[model samples]
Target: MAIYHLHAKVISRATGRSAVAAAAYRAASRLHDLRLDRDHDFSNKSGVVHSEILLPDGAPERFLDRATLWNEVEAIEKRKDAQLAREVEFSIPREMTQAQGIALARDFVREQFVERGMVADLNVHWDIGEDGQAKPHAHVMLSTRRIEVRIGEAVHGRRDGIPHPERGGRGAYDLAPDPGPDGAERGRRSTQAHDPSADGNSGDAARHPAEALDAGEALAAAGRTARLIAAARLRHEGLGLAQDQPSIGFGAKERSWNDKDLLLTWRERWASLVNERLAELGPVRA
Candidate 1:
């Protein structure tokens, strides 16, 4: 997997100078081997120096290629002088290759400019590492001219959807239900009666409150025993103590207490054991 990065910068000539000379100066300054005096004509004049060079990784070379580079520069020139736009930068996941990153960057630039009906000759460079081990990235040089019209509109209502009338309108009172004849007095009497089957058994043979509590305690003890056994096995393996034997801790015995304090303490101890086991595994990969 590779990461994608895009960076853009503006290139223009010095004050009071020709656009051609500025463009030429910028183009020549970008060459690694070429010098101002030795390889290009801008050596003595010094009229226009490559004012700003913004190179995102892998972007420079692609922008330098004559056929494609000229197109980018043309896009920049299409924008007017007064409205200078800032450079754009973005990064994407590494799944895209160097060539793919460059293509995406070019497409993104074209879409944005086309929407504004502006054309400028921009340079895009792709920076790919040696043997392609590093993530792919790109740098773009764009013109600052403003070619598109800016429009503004006032927004009133909620953007999501229309407001619900029930929630927004004036509140209404709900009417109470009316009972049939011989109703109000009968309803009051029925509400005051006690439930006979509150105990699990029938009303005549209801179990005592103490007996029910004992049964509940017995069931809880059995469940705790099972959980203790499982926890012992996990702890033994996690600690690298006994290969097959179960391990026991103070927290397991404390379960017999039924007190909230003891139960909470045991839970904390179990959580600590879980954390220790995970820490041994080290950081997760990717």
Candidate 2:
């Protein structure tokens, strides 16, 4: 019997669930949750036939790794009760081969989700049921938020009197020495560079100018980062910020995905795909 089943749910912190854990379990791989500082090891877990991340065309390349992808989701969501992701579990026809099922799932995911600008983590599994029959399915974890990648250096201003990379490092407004933490203009580096006590703290020693350059360079290295802001937050410019690209994120949850009418439409689409694939196979050649 060919089955068509698609179920969707929100993976939210309010339910004490983690997107990182869900991704690791579905992929049967080990992943570290950067936000929770915990490790999820399911590498020995069986039944994972294929696992891959299908990022939207312009999505960050770093998210290609399952762990890094989910970790970024965790990082973007700061609230304790944030909705981390949406998990869509669908059944693959038992008549389909492993490769066929994977292909079908990937196609469905790409057309339904990726084309609409969502990052999907797809995992196909084939396990024996209690009846000793092959039960094949796939789990797709879709990011509830949208991705925005900007090209620039990260600027952390004035940590320990060190200038950030954005403070005019290339000689624009930055050609002159930057002001110190006290709002006073900085003196020449040739004079300040030798003062061990120039830092003006009780027991702290002054840092060399070159060390500040190293720190700034390190900040610059973290370029072209992605911001995962939810669509809800994007709409309300004054709402909770996901990454400041005129969008929603952590401001309010998106509701269109759970609409009864939309779900019905998705159900129909899934069934149509299954029927089309089976029809293409032509009655098993008798």
Candidate 3:
């Protein structure tokens, strides 16, 4: 039986590791970290089945080289504790052929990371498990920052763009919005307007914000209802007696995920792919 596991991590300078070393170890090749003035070599390392440096469609041709890729990352990040790279480790089902497995992995990486402007250095390995079985897996190293490739220019898509809104800066240069959610949910809306069932009573009730309030909204609504009931009961109990009252207001909308969300999202995506491939293969023979 094939297991489902996808892990994501960061290689940071705080951990006393460099991008060059991570790349060399995964690729089983040699790369020199010019910033640290040292060489990282793993050419004789074993169990490396395949390795490749993958870039977005319009990335500069020079970045095709692994050494150049990691070196650029090191050069871009100047902080002592900067994150050098993001790594994702996932299990590959032994049921699929080598070509199929590689193709699936690359497809997932390209769609999930590279398409969203990340340069991925991916490696596949075969190792012996504790039970003496062959365990095949793939490791993906990613760029920390968002990127975009233009004509002869590598654009760093910064989340914190120019013209600070809260800083009272002058020129508020408008930056392009992110291309929505990643992976399968990219460009997909939370609700569809063209649903046939939207005309029904249940669907209408479900879609209405007032009727379909979330946990926080429900809590606020319940508080308001309680206050109204308490006021009526007080008036009935004592027709002329009155006490101090407090004001109430609604809370803000729910907050979304941060850095950790991205990792979990990618992990779920990989798991989905594994299930898809298994379904395609159908039940295995005894």
Candidate 4:
């Protein structure tokens, strides 16, 4: 899967706003004034300024409809106990579908707040790319409130006969087999040679199907299945964000293929485009 990073900043000068509070005010105002169809205006109710929406366009006409964006802003403000000062950074993986990307981004903001043990209210927006492809991304404006942390104990148990003193027990004990004198075979041929019903049944008796496989053999099979599942999931997620190249085909796909090949090309093209459109942002400093 390809991975790309997206960055967005608010146009404070245009709206005569600078801080998070100002940004939130302007966003609420714009939302209230939006004339989507000359008949409908999606305005916020009194005392309810937070909003979020997803708009599919290169530069969405209305970008502050998504709630997560504002939630993030609110989160930052609360965390700092002051106005948000700069653009927030989002690490987006290219393996998500446009819609999935939007959902993931929204979820990510919530997850971030949860990880910090905070609750946030805010607005969000998603914009597409010039190619009309869903370059799903968000703009978050949030409140500035710090969230409190909650703690809990973790419990663990073992399937084997091992005990854990840390969890209020005597702890696990290991029993090692005693070696015979002069390094000779120990203890009745290990029950495999004499008893047919033993784990191996080697005394000229038919081997049980279960005994035919060793622990290593069983684990190897399971490992292969797990890898296959992981690879499939990765490929599925990556396809949503990157263009499918003809060389990467079904039934012949290889995980070793470098996603950088796709990402690098996109980066080069995007750099040129962004430089042209936002020359005032200055050259990408290193």
- Would you estimate the TM-scores of all the predictions? 0.26, 0.63, 0.62, 0.27
- By TM-score, the best candidate is 2
lDDT of each: 0.32, 0.63, 0.62, 0.32
- List model 1 lDDT by residue over 12-116, tens digit each: 221122233334443443321121222224434322211333333223445334333433343332223211222333442344444444455455545543233
The number of clashing residue pairs in each candidate reads 23, 8, 0, 25
* Cα lDDT for residue 278, candidate 2: 91
Structural RMSD, model 2? 20.4
Model 3 error, position 79 (Å): 0.6
lDDT of 2 by residue, 141-186 (tens): 8876555432121111221122322221111010112231211312
Top-scoring candidate (lDDT): 2
Cα deviation of 113 in candidate 2 (Å)?
Answer: 0.6
RMSD of each: 34.6, 20.4, 20.7, 25.5
What is the C-alpha lDDT profile of model 4 across 1-286, one tens digit per residue?
A: 2334533222222223334333445244432211111111234523222244322222222223333333233332211222232233243333344444445555555544323322223343434558764443343432222221211111112111221121121111111121312122111111111123332445332334345657997688567757765665465466652222222101111112112332234335434433443344343333
RMSD of 1: 34.6
- Estimate the lDDT of model 1: 0.32
Q: Is candidate 3 or candidate 4 better by TM-score?
A: 3
Error of 1 at 167 (Å): 52
Query: Which residue runs of candidate 1 sit more than 4 Å off their true CA positions?
Result: 1-9, 12-93, 120-132, 146-286
